[model samples]
Target: MRRLFRLLTIYAVFARYRLDELLPDHAASGIVKFFIRLHPAAWTASTQVHPWGRLRLALEQLGPVFIKFGQLLSTRHDLLPEEAIGDLANLQDNVPPFGEQAAFDIIEAELKGTTEALFGHLERTPLASASVAQVHAGSLKDGREIVVKVIRPGIETLVQRDLALLLTGARWLQKIVPETKRFHPVQVVTDYRHILLGELDLGQEAANGAQFRRNFADSPVLYVPEVHWNLSTNKVLTMERVYGVPVSDTQSMLAAGVSLEHLSELGVEIFFTQVFRDNFFHADMHPGNVMVSLKDPQNPQYLSLDCAIVGSLSKQERFLLARQLMALLDKDYEQIAILMVEAGWVPQSTRIHEFQNALRTVLEPVLERPLNEIEFGPILIRLFQTARRFEMQALPQFMLLEKTLIHVEGLGRQLYPELDIWEIGRPLLEQWLRDQIGPGAIMQTIKRNGPALIEQIPHIPKLAWDALQEMRKLSENQQKLLQQVEQGHLKQLRRDRIITLLGLIGLGAGLSWGFNPHWSLSWSEIPLGAWVISALGASLILTRLRSNPDD
Candidate 1:
């Protein structure tokens, strides 16, 4: 009954927002028409509401789960319209907290102790709250200030229940809707399910945070909070509490004399460093999870939180992604098309000319804008959408990267509206690409594996001899197989010849019986067996000629 009510409320919100306008024009009649009519504002273009606006409003009304999904969807500019993406970007994840008592209960249960034993002082009120969890300010028994994050009571059950509902809707949409299969709604839900479930495990998030801290340990641009493992569990987390201005608090940052330009550019640098240098990145980089330090406003470093979602790519994916980005920056659609095929993103059989043309068609307009005016994230997303038309399969790893890129760029633009992202990112990417293939990399590889290489050097001669022996045996087997095939061919040829000779003799006899004057046999006197022989003989002769045209 709860699920049914929630589902009905979602439909009501959809109708209230006139989201059904997103349906195809053909759907305005028939069984779909009744549902379409449920929308209060349908066909009211004078209302000054765009489809994207309605979508954003509807998601916001649907609750935190839907809002988060919208936030994820907003990042994929390649998959949605500009207006829609823009509207969804405004979706916020803030939701009302369940209850302070419930949070305390969860922490007590997870820690196997009363709050008084674990902390010298535990705040009855939460410091922050979101859909999945809430955080409380507390002081350890040892006098260190920390924050205790407790998973919302019964959140697992709620998330699973809502996810099942989402999957049902996705299945229904795919069945009844047209042109939506490309979005792969069901697959989106499945992927979200995995990520959400992973986020539910505080242990995994602690590991991610710890790894991120190590990756940026020596760096001056970003700060990752330290996780208190001794006090952490699967459903509870205790971490060092750092005070800084929220990255979204630009006015406060400006008041503190923070250099917005440097901060914006540093965001780009940090992103590239994490991806190319460390190969591990915090995927959920929304403004809510980021903070700007006040210690050095001139050389501002970012503080990141909520490490539940992180991402990395395979070596091949990193290479291809870098090359593709460079190609796009250069406006070399042809190179991008070639790379797509080479990277196996598109089928090898995809026509290069057509693919190139398609890429240029999608990218030309985006590239025509000024370097500072163009959005790097959206263009990259648009490339994915265009590639889809050429039957390019979705790369799940890239999805995380793409989402992170959108967050980084969006936050950067907020800090400095005129920021040239390409200018900031291009040099870093180029340098990384060069370092990957340069002589220095080779020297480093050899130096790292010097011992293994030296140990294998002694076996080189024996390995070469074994390879030669194997090749020799393979060659001999190949020759024997070819000989057998030729012998079989000759035997088949001889058999065919015999069959043709017998067929010809039968044909000749049939002709003599029917037409030859010496045989004195008319057509009426001819035996049916003779006709059958003649037909069979003709078929055999044709078959032999077709098989060996040289004959």
Candidate 2:
């Protein structure tokens, strides 16, 4: 019954905003328009505001989930109209704060103590109120300034209810419009559900913050405030209070003598460093969570906040991504297409030349533009959209990274219109690639694993002997199977071939061990016993192959 009510509320809001008009002309839209026109609210709905403005207002009225949806939509410049994207960009997490009493109740309950006992002084009002939580300024017992972030009470319930409604709506839309399947609305909502729920856990956010602080402990590029673990809980987080001009507050930052050019470059540097060097990065880098430090205006630094959502890629993914970026810079569309298929980002059967042509058609014009005029965010979006034509699947792991890149690019451009991320990022990426595959990296890998290899050296002879014994048994078995095959038992021929294949694999393993680079001993210096094993294994494999060429 409650869900039905929520559905009705959503419908009323949709009608009130006349959102049906926003839909493209289609059979589905015609049906929706007919129903909306029949509704009494639609007749009385205000027409004074632009449709985009009405849409934004309706989302805000629907609460946090919808407001966040609007924010996400704002990044998709290709999908949304310019005016709609502009309006949605204005959707901020500026929800009104809950009462002061409720805030104190939550903090006390989470910390297991009264506000007065836990702090020297706690504010009666919130410093900032966002969709998921609100922050209140306070001082610790040691007179250190801090901010207590308290998750709004009952928000989890509200989020879950809204998510369920969203999922239903998504499924309904997909059913009504089969073409929407490519967009994967259901999976998108499911991912958003996990992200929203994760934001509800302050403990996770605290851990993320601690790790980020440690990553940049000595760096001037960024600062992550200290997390007060003792005073934090899943419901409440306490951290050192930081003061800086918001990155979006251009006038204030300029007044403080902050170099916008340096600041914008630093933003790009911070992103590359976090993604490539540390592998862990704060995924939520919107202006609200980022501020510019004033300690040194000439050498500006970023103060990062709200580390609840961070992103990291697997080692293989990082390597492939670096190669892909390098290829993009070099205009090697063929390599980009090859890497996408190799990474399983696209189907294995994808026609490489065709894919390359598609990429070139989409990206050549963008790459032709001046470095300062190119927007990496939209380019990535276009690349993914092009890949979708060849049946590229959804990449849930990259959603946060994509969102962060868009935020970073948007913020960098806002700070300095001429910010050339390509200039700032190319060298860092090149250096990182060299470090990953150069001789130093090889030495480091060997040094890290040398001890274990040495420890296993003594057991190699025993393992090799065991393998030889197994080979002998298999050889004997193959002889019998081959004899049976000669007697017209064709089934035994397949078994003989299987035994021969196994023996070949065992011999290959022994040969690889003998030639392993970590072994300091030369071929002449190798123990006689090891040489015997290698020779015997090689001779057996050769004899079998010579005797049965088909096998």
Q: In terms of TM-score, which candidate is strongest?
A: 1
Best by lDDT: 2
Q: Write the per-residue lDDT of candidate 2 for residues 1-551, one digit (tens) a residue.
A: 88889888988998999988788787987988888878889999987899899999999999999998787667554345558877998986778999899999999988899999999999988998988999999999999999999999889888999999889989998999998776778887887777777889999999999999999998889999999999999999999999888999999889988889988998999999999999998887888899988888888889999998788998778888899999998999999999999987788999999999999999999999998999998788778778878877646666667778888999999999999998989999999999999999999999999999999999999999999999999999999998977876566566566656766766666666667678887877766655666666667667667867876
Candidate 1 vs. true structure, TM-score: 0.85
Per-residue error at 24 for model 2, in Å? 5.6
Model 2 ranges with Cα > 4 A deviation: 22-37, 46-54, 76-87, 174-176, 346-354, 384-394, 448-466, 469-551
In model 2, what are the clashing residue pairs, if there are any? none
lDDT of 1 by residue, 45-76 (tens): 33368888878878877766777678777766
Pairs of residues clashing in candidate 1: none
